[model samples]
Target: MANSPHGGILKDLYIRDEPLKATLQAEAETLPHVVLTERQLCDLELILNGGFSPLQGFHTQAEYTSVVTTSRLPSGALWTIPIYLDINRAHLDTLGAVPGSRLTLRDPRDDQPLAIITISDIYTVDRTQEALQVYGTTDEAHPAVHYLRHNTRDTLVGGDVQAVNAPQHYDYVAIRRSPNEVRQLFKKLNWTRVVAFQTRNPMHRAHRELTVRAARMRHANVLIQPVVGLTKPGDIDHFTRVRVYQAIMPKYPNGMAQLSLLPLAMRMGGPREAVWHAIIRKNFGATHFIVGRDHAGPGSNSQGVDFYGPYEAQDLVLKYRDELDIEVVPFQMLTYLPDTDEYQPINEVAEGVKTLNISGTELRRRLKTGAPIPEWFSYPEVVRILREANPPRDHQGFTVFLTGLHASGKESIARALQVALNQEGGRSVSLLLGETIRQELSSELGYTKRERDINVARIGFVAAELTRSGAACIAAPIAPYNEARQQVRKQVARAGGFYLVHVATPLEACIKNDRAGVYARAIAGDIKGFTGIDDVYEAPSNADLVADVTKTSISQIVHEIILLLERDGYIGDR
Candidate 1:
């Protein structure tokens, strides 16, 4: 393994005892052509360069052998039961990152070791963005849309929603996170053997019943990762659905289940979506997923094959089960019982009209007005969430936080911190100079760099405020806070990738060159506390640059900063 041509990463990588890749390559070597996406190509390049490591996996024969005995998971069902699997159709339907099963593989019975077999490859995906041609119709008020519209008003946030903004499409569901994060989250956890349940509807009693039953049957933990975006014709507004989800969380058995929201734009690719759904779940750490009739239908197709039957989805899930690494817990339609006033599986319900039918049209009508949703039909908590998310229309601003070292020239590299606001006043990027901010924290204390960081965030509020005012400000403060920087970075990352600049000025020069007289005061004991004198500075290892202020002049420094800004495309390309 060490002598392998791929270089040093093979040793560091999770090397399987019985290299499954060879066998996987053999078994899948002749399968329908496997293409690599740009991201996947990037990952492969990195792997060859010894920058990334592939997850190690153990071999298993679950697909060949039948499931034996195991205790039920938190949902309370026997574990390791037989499940129908489909071996064809691009493994799981989705390719890009849309949250269903994208790639499949095999997991050991204990659910710890995983064998990597398939992956979501290829960059080319359908990009048609016909605005949400969904399945149901909005009621009189259309509360779901109304809810989105209402909350979108005057929240007063910052960042570009268009330039960095990306709208979702179902056909091109790519794997979103990087390979490293994917390995850490998806492969590290002990979930080689599991079952997954999918849902288009919000948490109704019958839905929970199905999931609970599936968990019991597989003796696996249940990942109730719900779809939190647009659905087929007339789908419930995501916001409302999210609210309902938040409300109904407690109803789920504590540890066995967890929730994540999926943001997808609707397309009527039912059977295809079933595949897509499985892959996304695989990306998100689920080893199984549920698929049913009309998995990704828009309204109802004329052929009325219902997109794909529940069983078709089952077959698809199984065929590529190894590629998916997860199992599908296919549940037949669930229904509500009026007499018992409880939800039951369709298999258990008595004949005739007593079987409660759940329809998107009906659900929308009930949600339009603030009607009391019955527990028997749906969990009460989920209903409360529905009310909040049931409206539509425009959006307010979102959040943006800046990270990086104070001197790292992040702001300067970004030129985000303009000294003269009056210069070219029309530009959106405003500069928040840390030089000016230090005045807010008198030099008398000779404040440590950490103290300066706390001050930076305190001032970040001011930056945040300025951003909301429709001006993207460039702020620079000698903020020596890696953690705080991360916090701000995450806030801004949702809006756009944060630009970090570590003004790498050596201590000897930075202090010798101090214009604020901080070094002079610290050296002479005039200031008992100074950043480098009394405190520490954890140099950034992965900084975008090492702006050696020690060797460069201010003009040259600013020029480099401008170049950085141009490189990041924050400003026009130089």
Candidate 2:
């Protein structure tokens, strides 16, 4: 039989009464509204659906402090991380949100009301202390720490949440199971002794071997519960990972394993996260959980040191073994033994035996370069899904972004690069010049810092679309702000390669080379907010290539950029 929920009962907060939901929906219109971020939305869905069992809503100040300090709720239940409803002071004042007031929480993707929170406490938290206590570090390199410092607001609004509706998910609806639903499925399948495996990455041959071995060792069935919500910031997107999971499902032994999606926003808290995962699995009817080395670990910190020891998660899970109500099935690193055509734990492998394994970094490199991935590492179906998602660089799209001061020869270089790419003829080429984008996409915008950032973002959006469609995009925008440029880089990089080029034309040279009198007019105070005169232009310090028109010909600079693309396998050598 399945273990009882964390606090002995699963709290399904979704209001199934249609009339009450309609009443709440109507009442929500008159109340102040709070739009949830992507992470918050994921958290809310789990909270409402009993995936985060025993929790009724976002944490109050007391609960937050208790969890942060001692890894326990105020009720003394084992809770590892804090779940907060963060709001800025401006929003709070605008909403007039005080204790006893009700606020509707709407989805940010669409302004659909999903839940209502009756405010119980509005307070601030010591984020630094929370970071140290929960994540063990304040390093910005940690994705959760970075999000806590930059993305999250300081003030937290705590209350009991009433769900108007579950967050609508259109993808993989069949596999998106709530805690109760999974528990019911396990009951129907007669899977009493179930071992759960939590993963955020795509499963491979080793993962299959590990889970199968774990199930056999425990005499249990297996549940592959993968996080479909916000994982570590550069981790594979959930869509691709889910498809890979789907492809690899048949590889599991018949009646031995099942796959389910968990909408979890992982904190990457390492040991604490592992414990939390075990508790969540227990709620989902798993009597046992497979805790691998560095389970839920977020690689390394800023100094290139691991955040936690290899066995820290396993040790912590074992420490709370009695209280968690789930058995920890610990496993070491599994490597393929070519001699026996099977996998064995690294510690158990014989000395001088030939072993082969592919690291995640190496797998990604192989995918990027169209190198062969062996059947020993992954199934063909799984490899096909991954390859389809990540095509080789030569077949993928890319963006070349050139930014500089006014009249800095960026447009000239962009046009030349576009023509060169078009002549090469593998993929369509797009040229997005700043003036053209200003006239077309951002006509209503001005030259203020905010407007300029929006303009650059608009160019980035179009370029990102072009890149996603397997085209070469050359964007010449005076993307003066480094932050905006970096944002564009991230946006385009998600689709394909993003190469930033700094057209480092000297300001004096720009003034001399001006075909129009805009630079002179700006200097003479005739043109207001003109770049290089009244407005600042923040140059990119991390550009992939730096070109100066004063020292090199346009053809030579274009050739150099092509060479960069060729070096990265985005283009074949001419």
The C-alpha lDDT values of all candidates are 0.45, 0.89
lDDT of 1 by residue, 1-574 (tens): 0111111122223334445545543543333322322222222222222222221111012311221222111233222211111222343233332222223222222221122233222122111110111112222132222322342122111110001001223431432332233334433455444455555666777667777777777666665655544454355655565556556657768766655544433334444346556654554445557665445544333444343344655675566565444566666777777777766667766567576675767776666434456667776566667655552111111122333333333444445335432242444555556666667543443455556566766655665555444455565566665666655555544333345556776676565555677677777888764566665555655555466655665557556655654454344411
Q: Judged by TM-score, which candidate is best?
A: 2
Worst 10 residues of 1 by lDDT: 156-165
> How far does residue 358 in candidate 1 sit from its true spot (Å)?
3.7
Query: Candidate 2 has which clashing residue pairs, if any?
Result: none
lDDT of 2 by residue, 315-420 (tens): 9999999998888899999999987899999999888999999999999999988899999999999999999988898989999999998788999999999889
Q: For model 2, what is the error of residue 525's alpha carbon versus the real structure, in angstroms, after optimal superposition?
A: 6.1
